[model samples]
Target: MVDRPIIFSAAMVRALLAGRKTQTRRLATSPLRRVEVGDRLYVRESMHLWSAGHDAEVTFAADDRSFQTGPNTGDIPDASLTAYFRMVDQSRAKGRRISRPSIHMPRWASRLTLIVEGVKVEPLQSITSRDAISEGIERAGGEWRCYDSSGTGCLGARESFCTLWSSLHEAPGQRWQDNPNVVALSFRVEHGNIDTLYPNLRSARA
Candidate 1:
């Protein structure tokens, strides 16, 4: 199985962590089109880091929970820890917290991995109610709603998914109305660092 990095917004990260999300749809870009079942995706989410000497701690922006990273405390390797310390030092020198974009997160810092179970290509607007639910829509009081929404009007699953799509893809040709082709990926979440869970993959890469 191939291992790759995938970036997710903080909201989506929370959904994945909560077991509410099982599917994600991305524009049919070349990279996404290459993904296949059995491939592993290590999630990259917004995070902050703090360090004391060689020991460091990571605070995920999604839940704002800190976890120690080191040989004794976690699976993070020494090389990765050293790289994180450099980032921490640079941030402190600039008088700011060590926060970086999700895309910049290293694989060692990732706490969530997704194992692709299925893949398909379809129009963005073709998402069904069941698929929308799998995308992390919430059902409350007999109403399906987006997780970030208040569910005030109590929309259906498909409608809630539309709202979410609009929020994330507002650019021209990327909106829900655009009906752009998308790569739909269905996956199961694994709650651990990719390298830790798949040590053989790490060795192969090295």
Candidate 2:
């Protein structure tokens, strides 16, 4: 019944929002925070233009090309955002600087929940075509075995997946082909009255 926070790239976050992604893999580096069956993860999307907490409207200014009011900041528009504002505002008012990066987002701000169904530790290269598809790699056509002249499995499931992975994390060792071991987690979206699962509060304006 413990709640875990998982940070997802903006693209992955969108995929989850669209109900296209259901599985994810992570390095098994943190033994204390190891993921297990039945555990729930609150997805935190990477910082973007629309993540400004409690900031009712998008400042959408032309000069602010980076889309942040300042360093490490973005704005989000939602009614529930204000209630969260109060919680952090109290901290800020006492000189406790606000720092809510995507991964560090408060539990109350989470909009997506993933209930873990299974977990496995395996070599990263052991990922199969079926596993790649589960990891949200979409196929273009019937090119399951289509190979390039160089013998690379071009357009193949695992190939496409590796390409996608390299885009987000180029691997600390400088090459994705290094094939480090990872923990793969399969989860199901919990759909129902979320409010009953967690209470929502409206904070008073300061």
Candidate 3:
């Protein structure tokens, strides 16, 4: 194998940072398994975001002059993280097994945010929450039957919507399996900010 010297450019550095992505890691702060019917259970998870990869354009700016923007702040991809959380929740409901509950945001996702390159996904009407849940379940390799919270066939309550191949998954140890019911959880999602860790990456061109 040849020892190839790594080289970088300013444009490369700027390009890397020009775009971003976000991720979140959530844990069950309380005993989530005890969630019961008639209880308004919502998946609660802390969110963090960061740039997806080594692009010269990405830069980490701190609200304070000091480095480190605490947690949940940075070049994180907010939209992607939200999408990921929704995906995980959908999967869990469908009886799909999950280990971790952290969100994963990749570079390609950021690239797709643009209008030209981005996809045109219609906002799912709230009238299909059950369908969204069922679809999410099916994608996670679980059998699902559409029904509303009122126990009626098909969806009765709709809040949000999703599309095909636009979902996220748990990354092992994210969700508890023994209990298998995660209605509420808490954790932080961290996006990898190459600019923050190795600032030199931000100066690739220089």
Residue-wise C-alpha lDDT for candidate 3, range 76-138, written one tens digit per residue: 344334554444454446544222211222321221111111111222232234434332222
Across residues 27-125, which tens digit of lDDT does each residue of candidate 1 receive? 996386788898898999998877655556789999998887653655676546676556757755676567768999877789999999999999999
- TM-score, prediction 2: 0.63
Highest TM-score: give the candidate number. Answer: 1
Cα lDDT tens digits, model 2, 86-108, are 64455445554344457555544
RMSD of each: 2.8, 8.9, 20.2
Give stretches of model 2 more than 4 Å off: 31-33, 47-83, 87-100, 139-154, 172-175, 191-206
Clashes in predicted model 2: 4
Number of clashes in every candidate structure? 0, 4, 36
Instruction: Write the candidate numbers in order of decreasing lDDT.
Output: 1, 2, 3
TM-score of each: 0.87, 0.63, 0.16
In candidate 1, which residue pairs clash? none
Off by over 4 Å in 3: 1-118, 121-135, 138-144, 155-206
lDDT of 3: 0.25
TM-score of 1: 0.87
Assess candidate 3 and give its TM-score to the true structure: 0.16
Which pairs, if any, clash in model 2?
A: 51-75, 52-74, 52-75, 52-76
Using TM-score as the measure, what is the rank order of every candidate, best first?
1, 2, 3
